[model samples]
Target chain A: MILNIPFSDIVFYFVAVFMVLLSIAAVSSKNVLRSAIFLIASFLGTAILYLLLKAEFMAMAQIMLYVGGVVVFIIFAILLTSHLGENKLSTPISQKFLAVFLALTLLGVMAKFLFNTKELSESITQKSPEASSLIAYGERLLSYAPNGFVLPFEIISILLFMTLVVAITIAKKDNKEEK
Target chain B: MLPSVTHPIGDFVRENVPNVLGYLPDFIQPYIPSAEIATLINIIICMVAIAVVGIAPVPVLIYMERKVCAHIQCRLGPMRLGPHGVLQLVADIAKLLFKEVYAPKGADKFLFYLAPIFVLTAPFLNLCVIPFDKNLQVADLSVAIPFILAMNGFGILSTLLGGWASNNKYSLISSLRSGAQIISYEISFAMILLLVVMLAGSASLGEITASQSGHFWDWWIFKAPVLGLLAFIMFLVSSTAELNRAPFDIAEAEQELTGGFHTEYNGMAFAMFYLAEYINLFTTSCIATVCFLGGYHAPTIGILAIDNILNFVPGIVWFLGKTFFVVWIYMMFRWTFVRPRVDQLMALEWKFLLPVNLLLLIFGVVFLAFGWILP
Candidate 1:
């Protein structure tokens, strides 16, 4: 049975296991910094999985946005708020039980959402090479046809801009009274 | 016919590189997966070639930087080692290799060791996507632009980890500054890259190079009107900031922060950061060459005789020539400009570069919409 499996299948299984282990390491590590690093490794493992799935654009985006942008910001926040070279205590039993319950609930919701998406299942079974091309992705992003995503894309950009303005406003407010 | 003449060696190598597996005995071929083995070998060979290209130029770059600095400051530099001090870098590397490798007592040992390795990996990853010649790229992903940008982010991660793990205040402060500066400048950098992508109509580096294939004026810097030149200048400034070189070297400002993020690193670990800096310089210059200059395409002056003569030279030669020229420009910038205050650095990116980059993008869109690009 193992001999009958293709090379890509073996790679997929390996990457899936790697991601799971990294996720566990990330959650269980006592050191905040180490956990952050483990989280990034897991993100990178997801990127490799995307590559194996032939979603080249998505893989790069995953690396760029998650491992590069968001995690860096989170690390910065951690560095600012916490003392360096320190580790946190392990979780208590009650806290662990609560965390497990929350995680299970989230997983259940996600699973239900995934099972209900007909197009997602269809895409999984019959992938189109052209759908993964950068040009097609760009066109779809900016298009306003029935299946287009231009509205949501523009809305997201505007929302992000608003958030930036608000953040700057709040940050600068402290400086104004002193002046 | 011209391409055939110019890339004959490249074509031959690309064609035959995959057949190394076929040369293995049939008995072994049946035991192993031939296609997978061939791919693995190809990847390994490409990785080694890229590693050599990334690392082999460090000494030359170091020598050039020293000589350039010496000349600027009116002093002799490294005159004793070999002719013109060419062997100085070799001596420096040997000394670094033999030096003691130890983490600070309070340092995060695992992260401290991993930081240099991660720092060195970024440049190699970035270099793999670059088209050194017509048929010489290692991996030509559809999202090559984003992939390169993402690899650059790794540099910041390394700096943060290295600094934080060192258990020193100066390293931590320097790393924080680096994180902020790189993050800020990255926006402008991405915007400039977006301009080139818009002009090329594709994100693939190969396609971007092909888009600029024509006369000397067809290069992206000269392809459009004022927008391209403005974009090119912004590219230089933002990339310099991204590189954390002088003028943007506030993160490692010797006057304040002792040695910056690598303050605790010694010996080979320190050498890795140093070499990675130079390698990043080369890769960024290569990117500038490919995106703004004509990539591997030789210049055509509209004179058939001169153009034909130029075409006879291989693409890699042109590629390297343009790349080194940009590298020289970077070295000149390093020696000429003074480091900016950290606040000034932030202001420069947020107030100046970002707004201008957005305006250029708008203008570029307009120009592109009206089909005003140069032929």
Candidate 2:
């Protein structure tokens, strides 16, 4: 007897497959626009999974902001940056081999780690994990751990501030060279 | 002024809904066939609530506008139609309906007509998720805000498509302005939306409204002032632009872009767009209430000891009260405020509003991590 998969499960699988395919195409495609579009597809697929996981906010974050803003910006920048020089960006076999080796090794290590740990491995088996709502997520993020993750949160803020400063300084004309 | 008159809608609702357990859908309704019919009867009534309540607002809104403008300008407004011109809108609608629709020589006949339908689709759809009473929602989809946002897009597209199809140069310019302003504001509007999503936990409109109930402090407006404040501002700016209202009303800027997008449309074809514009104002206010202010939850005036008794107040009353206050705020901001230039509008969005919105989002997340309150 054949077991019937739930509609949601089938949808989740289809999205996952589509995401993997799009991600591969994102890396391999020669057309930059095609790559950006593929990346958006991957982002959307991931967002659907996030929605299925009941992380609605994160799902939209993936879609509206990341896909809508960041990807749109990247595509626009790429368009603005000029499309004339395709040959200049082409790389050789040695760089490709090195990247392939690094990726394969990283994947192998992750696969091995998954194989080794039973408790960590079991958690990965969950298809649909019950997650917090936006409010619940908010409260838990803030109030759960006694002292809270206040230090880390503050540090992240500082890091964001420093990054902003550095980005502006770099984006501005080279001051040291000018001096 | 009456301190706190518990609204009449709740009592009206109890009379409408049979309280007996048999009136409910499960087992109790089976013995008495009439009780079984009550739930179905309520569902049918629930569906028509939009038709009954939604269209009434357009006429009432017009009357309010007239009264408000009259007061501001120091003039006596329409006193001719049934008392203080309450039926003035009804007369206006009757006149508008019979007027001959003049299509421009250059306009695509179908799309020019279709624009009105597209514009009205949003307000009609807004009626879907609005919780009139506890069980009175059309589609309590888990993702109502996004659904509403999607509906808003359709409304924006109508203007764009309408202008483009007209083949008129000024009309095209107006449409482009509408597109630019609405699309740009949507990003920041969305970031603020995410902050609300973060606060409320769930995207379901009902969940967000329910979160605000029982007490004052539990309301999201007080939960995180930053989130509420940022979302409020973004919703305000975006809704203004979305409705094509000033100073973002550059779409219909009479002096510069001529009649802007509607330069080609006339008579009944034009009236549809006009009707839609007014309806959109109400839609945005309703959205603002749900997103930033807890929709329909009463403001702090007194402590409620018997909470079970008070949930009895029809949800629609809260929905309308919050919606009206927001609409009033928007009207004040528009008319009382000086309009900015188009360049300033774009700059305000890209340079100032967007960055502030982004920072507010991060702040919201940080507030969450600090054990600000129990979720």
RMSD of each: 3.8, 10.7
Over B58-111, each residue of candidate 1 has an lDDT whose tens digit, in order, gives 878888899989998999899998998889888998999999999999889999
Measured by DockQ, the strongest candidate is 1
Interface RMSD, one decimal, each candidate: 5.2, 10.9
Span of ten consecutive residues with least summed lDDT in model 2 chain B: B1-10
Residue by residue across B200-257, what tens digits does model 2's lDDT show? 7777777878777656666676677656665677778867876787667888988888
Interface DockQ of candidate 2: 0.05
Question: TM-scores across all candidates?
Answer: 0.91, 0.63
Worst 10 residues of 2 chain A by lDDT: A121-130
Range of the 10 consecutive residues with the lowest summed lDDT in candidate 1 chain B: B1-10
Can you write out model 2's per-residue Cα lDDT over A1-179, one digit (the tens) per residue? 01333345666778989999999988887766557657866987887887666676566456556654566556545434443225444679999999999999999999998888877434222643335345455556566378466567778878986875465456344545767
lDDT of residue B286 for candidate 2: 77
